[model samples]
Target: MRALIVRHEHVTEPGLVGDRLAEHGYRLTTVTVVPEPRHHAPDVPFDFPDAADWDLIVSLGAPWSVYDHAAVGSWIDGELALLRKAHHLGVPVLGVCFGAQALTTALGGSVEAAPRPEIGWTEIETDLPALVPPGPWFQWHYDRCVLPPGAVELARNAVCTQAFRVGRSLGVQFHPEITTAMVRGWLGLGGAEQCVRHGVDPHALLAHSRAMEADARANTRLLVDGFLEQVANTTA
Candidate 1:
């Protein structure tokens, strides 16, 4: 099987999520929308590949908002179109954070700034514990997803909808693909200041992430297994 991984920025990588997908016998193909050079100005034109060609799609988190046209540029619309086409074609998508927001928007929902940004690890309330485990999942988003029409909300926390499903796609408001190195990279790129603004100690957060690496891997394994068995295999 083939999996198309959409990386929105230079820092974010598939990490454990990609590892699990590889374990599931998938050949992964990653496409970056905004490279390192274009981080500050991400409005560059990018041609998203056809989603129909892949067996599964995974859209990783980004530091930008889906509704921010001026910030994300015109490529957001093309990505939205790709997601819509994927949903209509029964292609399974796993959307994380910003990706989740994009999925919601593509499926007739809308994205909005959250009451407050959710940073660090948080355990959400899950309707389907087998698939969407209530976890201390890594989170770093300033926006939230309003459910798309007919989408089953899988999980949520006090702040926002954490996970949802439409067609054969699943969207999560947290980052299941995060790694310590990724967090470090984020910290290097103004994340420390962002954390300080949110009352989160960047150093402690990094240490905590390092400590929970094993647990994270275990949780990701379960998440991937359940998603493949229960969600992805389900027909549109």
Candidate 2:
């Protein structure tokens, strides 16, 4: 099997999810959507590959908001079109964070700025624990997905909706693919400043991530397995 990973930025990698996919004998083909110089968010022109070519599509997170069309409307428009096409073609999609918001928008839902941003590790309430596990999951988003019509909400919390499923697609607001290295990279790219503004201690967040590294890996593996067996294979 093959997985097409849609990385929104250079710093946002597949991390543990990619590792699990590789272990399951899936070849990864990564496409970086925005490859602009430096870590500054920019509106760059790019094209997604043919969605029919890959067995699965994994859309990674981004620093930008999905609702900010005026800023990233050009590429986000193409991304939404591609995601809709992929969904129509019955391709299984795993959308994380901004990708989840993109998926929701692509599937007749809406994305908006959250009342309160979730920055650190937080626990969620899950209706489908086997599919969407309860956390202590990593979160770093200012927006929230309102969920598409016909979508089954799998998880949520006081702040926002956490995870949902529509047809062959699954969207999770939290980052199960997070890793210490990825967090470090994000921190270097002004994430620390954002954390400070949000009243979050960057060092404490990093420490928590380091402590949960092993558990996070195991949980991510379980999530991948569940997605493959339940969401992907069932639809196939």
Candidate 3:
């Protein structure tokens, strides 16, 4: 199987998710939207690949919100079109954070600023243990997605929707793809400053991530397996 991974920025790579995809024999083709050296620049041009060639599409997290179309320029619209096309074709998609927001928008929902930004590790309530675990998922977002049309709400907490599923596509608000190295990169790249601005202690965030690395990786692996097995195509 082939999976197209849409990497929005330098920091948020596929991480453990890519590892699991490889384990499942899914070859990954990553399309880095804003490569290094120009990653922080706003309104950079984004070139997306044709989604039909891939068996699955995985959209990773990003610092930008889906509603920031003006700042993101035409790329946001292009991505939304891709999401819609993939869905219509019954091609499975898994979206995280900003990707989830994009999925929501593509499915006729909206994204907006949350009541409060979520940073660091947080728990989400879920009955779908086959897909999502109950505790300690990485989160770093100021936006929340409204449940899209025909979507099933799979998980939630006081702060956000957490996750939802529309047919074979899943949109998760939290980060299950974060590895220790990925977390460290995020913290080192002005993420600490953003946390401080949000009244979050960067030190504590790092400590929490360090403590949860083992459990997080295990949970992420399970989620990845579930996504590929239950959400993607199967030959009967």
Best by lDDT: 1
lDDT of 1 by residue, 195-215 (tens): 999999999999999998998
Q: How much is 6 displaced in model 2, in angstroms? A: 0.4
Deviating ranges (above 4 Å) for candidate 1: 234-236
lDDT digits (tens) for residues 1-236 of candidate 3:
88999998887888888888888888899988877787677578876877788788999999887888766778888899999999998989999999999999999999989999999889889969888887689999999988877988889999889988898898899998888778789888889899999999998888888899889889998888777677664421
Clashing pairs in 1: none
- TM-score for candidate 3, please give it: 0.95
Q: After superposition, how far is residue 220 of candidate 3 from its true place, in Å?
A: 0.8
List the candidates ranked by lDDT, beginning with the highest: 1, 2, 3
TM-scores vs. true structure, each candidate: 0.98, 0.96, 0.95
lDDT of 1: 0.91
lDDT at position 90, candidate 1: 93
lDDT (Cα, tens digit) per residue for candidate 2, span 1-236: 88999998898889999999988888999999878493365688888888889899999999998888766758898889889999999999999999999999999999988999999899899998888889789999999998889999889999889988888888999999999999999999999999999999999999999999998998888788888888777432
lDDT minimum window of 10 residues, candidate 2 = 34-43
Worst 10 residues of 3 by lDDT: 227-236
